[model samples]
Target chain A: MSSFRVVLGFELKEYFRSKGFMITTFLIAIIAVVGLSIPRFIDLGFNRSEEGSSSREFVTDNSRVIIYDRMGYLPPDELLQAYSNFQYAGSEKEVEEAVSEGSADKGFVITGPTSFKSYIYNADMFADEGAQIGRLLSYGKARKYASENNIDFEQFKQTLNPEISSESVILGKDTRGNYWYCYALVIIIFMMIIMYGQMIATSVTSEKSNRSVEVLVTTTNPNSLLFGKVIAGAIASLFQMSVILCAAVLTYRVNREAWGGLLDMFLNIPLRVLGIFLLFGLFGYLFYAFIYGAIGALVSRTEDISRSASGVMMVIMVVYFATLFQLSNPDGIVIKVLSFLPISSYSAMFARVALGTVTLVEVIVSFAVLLISVFLAGFLAAKIYRMGTLRYGNPIKLGVALKTIRRAKKQAKKLAKEQAKEGIETANEDREER
Target chain B: MLLEVKDLVKSFGDTEVLHGISFSAESGTALGLLGRNGAGKTTTIRILMDVFRADSGEITLDGNPFSAGDHWIGYLPEERGLYPKKKVCEQMVYLARLRGIHKTKAMENVDYWLDRLEISEYKNEKLEKLSKGNQQKVQLAATLVANPEIVILDEPFSGLDPVNAQLLKDVLNEMIAEGKIVIFSSHQMPLVEEFCDDIVILNHGDVVVSGRLKDIKKEYGENRLILSSDNYSMPELRKVLESQMSDIVKIDKEKKNFFVLEQKPKVTRERILGRLLNSSVKIEKFGVFEPSLSDIFVAKAGDEYE
Candidate 1:
């Protein structure tokens, strides 16, 4: 086997054998399973209306409402029909006193055909009682006007409240339906990048600090060591994430009816969207993993990992927030531009595919750019890792390391050219001698 | 087979660490690489292992250019470590496989080395759980797990007790007997003197001395003699020499029962022996003075010692 494969195999075995990795993955998968299966084991009242109780009955079951009408527009019979918990009061002052003294949960006084005053001891942010009472008063006034004008009240009522049946025909992507899943995917990729990236960096720094890198470098080339480590990390993290996601999606599908399909936007993800997410997420992870590995090599101690990786962390954070903010407007210029950029495209392009209209060409172009960037980053990281292998003591700054690599490359090119020149001259001298 | 490193020059950035260092080692013999700290011993070894490219150099084995990737090289660096949290056998196999050993062979080599080093019982144990000496043994096992044709040991005797050190010496002897090329580097001069057939002493990235151990010692021992008398103490012997043989010999070092004498210009050993016999001093031991490897090392590379 090649050295790269050997190193990769060892690293993967390390991950699989690690108790922390196994336990953490199991715990998160269990959490996802239970969280998605919650509706099956518990009653969330989503089907309450199917049990023969209207929303009004459910909301006003035991609450009392005191009413006082100054204009006498609302008849008591009509008001009682609408709200069975209603009680009459002679004056608005009486209604207020009734509410204040806790005799009624709410009180309303009708002042005009479409206006009302509400009284409550403590206001509830979600209360819609005033709007309900206003509608009732408006109906009462309309009935009275029809009766006085000698028109049939029933016909007038039918004319005023006509019911229409309609069905929606979505012509394009259902942004509202796909919004939650895209949002979730964006966050997942962000977290995976940050967490696994740091872990890769820490592993590299650990080897350096513990002085195992000396043996490793001699045993295998730096490129093999670094690429193997990074690819192993990416695979391990992706495995964990896939387990958790598959658990959630499968459990949610099994209990979709129990949840009344309320979480469909999040759990009922389309396969194509998921495929895009995996592609972008994996490549994005490998790109950052290489950078993180290089950063790890720059530092000689594990404690210096965070300090060395802070710049990369900042970039990831910025990309995360930008992608999240543009989730609702996936078709906007910000998201469109971000979708083509390598660093942001992992999340941005997926979001556009999920919630916005995008062409296959756009996706192919974005992915191509990201793939190229990944390879470039990998090569640079391998170079930096090779340069930093024997360096110890204080952490070398990334800028300084890059400068050194550039200078070395220039020198190597010059030496190669000189050698070519020497070869040519030696050949010419041989020809002359012959 | 012979491994020859000719004009090996290496530099990091603008600072050249190895300046045209040259040495050669043959199969079935051990070469001691002696140097003070920062004398570029590790640098030279790294270049040989292809960890770093030389600024300018040529290395060959049996008349062909040597590429480290094509050969199995077991290198135990001075700053050596293994995964503390990993099983000994598992990591050893991993390291062996990195050198292109198949899994079955790697496992066999790991087991063989672990058994040879007397750490077979700890094969499944985490490295950190072992005692320090046992961990060092595991490190040695890791180095030899690939059954490499060439073995480079840096400070291999450090952190080892006398028994363990002897065990390592015996193992090294077996490798040499097997016709493996061995390069031993250490600060413990006596160990190197006991095992190595040839030596290269480096000072400030330069090879100050390179030759066979016997030849170097013979060249250093010229005109120097160790003399001891049964009847006279070292001071008494020195006094006698000062009084009767001052022109013939000069006392170099005075010890409890012996005197190390430097023969004067054009003086013969026969002349000294005849003069001592006439002086009536009972000569107990007399031989040419051979300098210790440590003495030669200190003489050549001591100025830069930290």
Candidate 2:
């Protein structure tokens, strides 16, 4: 326990003092803030300039229909006045000129008392406010005709507004937004584990190459040292990630209006989903940290660190790409199997839960598998570490190292038993003599 | 015996490196663990430090199982290493703390050792920035910062100039004065002769010769006799010594009519002096010289010493 504390304190001190650590945290915070603020800043810039200078634009805000009396059929001023926010023009050329000069949003020419030709910016006439006005005017004409024919306006209005109600239900999946939110969380967790796992490996390799492990191992248990270093790395990474996450949330909060309901994407996520993300993320990092440290110990020099770490990286990559591919097919058989795999489960199982296609039992079983696997990895890595650190030369293959570790353990056990037997024999002889 | 190693065996893969090596060192004495390359001196020290496990062996300290943590065994491996980028005092404090010293005490010890080594000014300086000799002093300081009960130094004098070597020698003498079991390994034979009270000579992973330094020299007996004469040409003295002493194996000429006669069976210094006086070769200085640790090491281990 004291050795653990010593190694932990030393590792933390080194990590905290490192310029790389400080700079990376600061840079990540900056990036997060910038990522959240850029869209809001752009929106503010557009809103401020456009809103301040455009009263005429506001005139067009409510359809600003320029009606050209081409047929001279609209001589009724009261009728035009009753239709609020409608612009009227005398000649077709005048309305055409107004529409062409961008002063009006749309224009119209009344060919007859009940019909008219409409002008719009694009073919999406339903989207144009002026087109709505044209439709409303045509409806009014028909309503007027109906009144003259003694028809009920209430029933006609009721025809325009229906009372039917309907609801949407996805059979076995969550909302699309929640699915994407879960996927985003999974990707972040995956990247974090990979990045920090590499850091742990590199740190261990540096210690070994520097030959500090010799002094360290002699003074303390290698297993305790390994655990302490791994924990330190995990804590450091989580601290940095939290800082960046907080920065992002703060930036979004400050520009809440500009986010335009983007926060809702995350807010709607169930708190339990976030809890699962955290749980799986922690176990995943622990699992990879042990493997990385063990691999790091196998190497004799700094140059071999990356090569030694490549195997672990490959496993991580497989999990990552497979998870990504399963994102679209979250309920597929491939993902179902992948969710049970200790490595991929951190991502795949959480994703399945987020998609609302996974059961609690599945999550518990997967999490249990991962937790047990992490403990086993830590144990095996420590064994490998104890053996690998003392042997220096070419990088030891993992197979060879494991075999040596097994033999060493057996030898240690045999030695212990013999020592115990010897102690017992000596005790028996002494007792008899007495 | 403060530290006793018995029949330690170590093997790597199919081959055995250390073949039943055994030795012991007492408190307040410096044991020179002498060996050539691949002589298993390092392997043995590593096992003692508990960096590597021996295949089979028993090490006891004061009749108790000598664990790695039995005492703060200060070790300076032949492959001298430290965090080159770390400050001198910081790494020293860290290492001292690893040996179970408290933080504040570790800091104080670091300061004391740095000051004693005359490197207080470079306490906060990165080890890489220090001169090679000063760096060596810092390494030595690190090794002694914990005030270890048993200290193992392998080739501690390597890469050091004569002045720095003397500085290290003085520090080691201080360790001996403190009653520390200092196990030193070095290729500089004269330095070993000066530092070691007990000697273990390893040849090809085997303990070829080991005992109290004085006893080993005595048991081997004084095989080389040196004679410095005033009036005698080289040919004349050679003829006189050769004709009388048939046991003389080799005669090496030194400067100013000095000659060293290697004898198979020990010859009394007085008898040689009588013969020289009878031959009219007036002796200026005559003494039976005990073989040096290096000579003994070479004679026992053969021509493998580099």
Candidate 3:
């Protein structure tokens, strides 16, 4: 424990004083804040109106009627205000000109048969609703005129809305804003575990390379030294990721009404994922920390740490990407398999739990696998650590390490055989003397 | 004994390395562990520090075997270790703190050591930025700062140019005076002579020679002697002494006008001189010579040091 404290203080001091660590922490916080802000911005419905900059829709030619129909939800006064915001264009050239000249956010042109049902938009311009408006107005007017002239208007008018309905039903209990809220919870946990695991591995490799492990191990046991590195690295990750998460939540709170459902989701669930996150985080930490510590010992230098850890890291990266792929296609065989894997389960289960698709049995199975792996990894790691502590300079060959363990077992067997033979010989001699 | 080792044996795989080695060192005495390359000097140190478990040997300190998580042994491995990026004081205090010293006390020890080592200005300097000698000094200070009961240093003089060697020698001398049970290994034979009271030299994983430096030199004194005469045939005298002391090791030779010899218990040096005088031999420059530890080491461990 004293050694662990020594190394812990050593590691924390180094990291805290490092320019790279400070810069990285700052950068990660920025990226997370930006990423979170983007989703909340999506939730805000793009209203720059908080700055009192009202959004407007522009129309030209006969396209005004289509614009009016598409935008008919506003009252007449609001519609008049839309006209003030709008600057009409007579031709395609004029529409482009208006958009280019900052007179319009979007531009449209209308040209068609008398029924008038075509829309054209410049690639650079926003969506065109002019042709849609023209069609609506012409058809609305023509139908009204036809009905007044005692002609049948049944075919003249078509339905304004399409006939389509879709619904999502969550299988388990949920607090709402359902899918997105669940996804956010899942992504955060998945990112944290994987990111922090690599941090632990990288830190171990670096310390080993510096021969810093020698000084550290002298004061602390293998477990505590490794534990501190893993824990400290995780704390750094959590700090970075939390800054981002908080920024996003604050953004949502500011635009509370616009993101009312999201707000409700936050308040209702209070990120139920947080509890599971903390639990799985601790569990997975010990699990991955062991793998890192073992792989770290196998390499003679820091450069080799990356290569030595490559096999496991590749598996982890693949699992991470696979979990991401399974997000949109949950319940696929691959996703199901991932949810069962100890390494992949953190990501997969978080994704499912966020999506409200996990069950109690599945969670239990995941935890069991995680717990078992942590124990086994720790055991194997401790052995490797004990052997590797004094084993220096040369890289530890997998074969040699395996052979050492085998040789130990062989020596035991050989000793036992010798003892047995000696016992038998002594017994025979005793009988002969008698 | 403060530290004891009995029949310690260690092997790597199928190869038996250290075979039933035994030695003990009491507190307040520095022991020089001498060995050639791959001689198990390092292996013994490792076993003693509990870095490697012995195959069959037993080591007990203060009447008890090693206990798990007992943080008492202080080791300075041949390979230097200091967090290059950390400040000297920072790393020193942390190391001191680990050995059960309070943070404040750790800092106080650091300050005193920094001043004692004459690099107090470097207390805040990064280890990497310091001169190599200064770094070595810090490492030395680190080993003793913990006030460990047993301290093991391997090639402690490595990387030290001559001046640093003197500084390190002084520090070691100080440590010895302070009653640290320091077990240090060095290839420099003369150094082993200067510092160690007891030494065990190993060759090929076995103890080839061990004990007090003076006693070994005294044991080699069995046949060595000096002689002078009034007048005698130099050739005849050489022939006679060579025939007489043939069993004793020859150190050097010139002519028998006056020659050195190892006096057998029965042959008194005065009696030999009187006999030479009676035989009409001229006597000059006759005195017994004792070997220095370095000379003795070279004499016994021979040729391999080159």
Top model by DockQ, which number?
1
Question: Considering every candidate listed, which one attains the maximal TM-score?
Answer: 1
Q: Model 1: which residue pairs collide?
A: none
- What is candidate 2's lDDT per residue for A13-81, written digit by digit as tens? 889899989899999899889988887757634234344333321212344558776555553443354
Pairs in steric clash, model 2: none
Please, what are the lDDT tens digits per residue for candidate 2 over residues B20-75? 99999999999999888889989999989887788887788986778876677888
Q: Across residues A143-209, which tens digit of lDDT does each residue of candidate 3 receive?
A: 6577789876654333433345698895664433444554555566556655666566677666566
Tell me how each candidate scores on DockQ against the true complex: 0.59, 0.58, 0.35
Which wins on TM-score, candidate 2 or candidate 3?
2
Model 3: fnat (fraction of native contacts): 0.36
TM-score of each: 0.87, 0.81, 0.76
Q: Is the docking of candidate 3 incorrect, acceptable, medium or high quality?
A: acceptable
Cα misplacement distance, residue B178 of candidate 2 (Å): 2.4
Model 1, runs deviating above 4 Å: A47-159, A267-272, A328-332, A355-359, A410-434, B11-16, B230-236, B239-244, B254-256, B280-282, B303-306
Cα lDDT tens digits, model 3, B5-68, are: 7677899868988987777776667788877788888888877766666676566667566442
lDDT of 1 by residue, B250-273 (tens): 987665577778999999999888
Model 3 chain A, poorest ten-residue lDDT window? A59-68
Model 2 / residue A370 / CA error / Å: 2.0
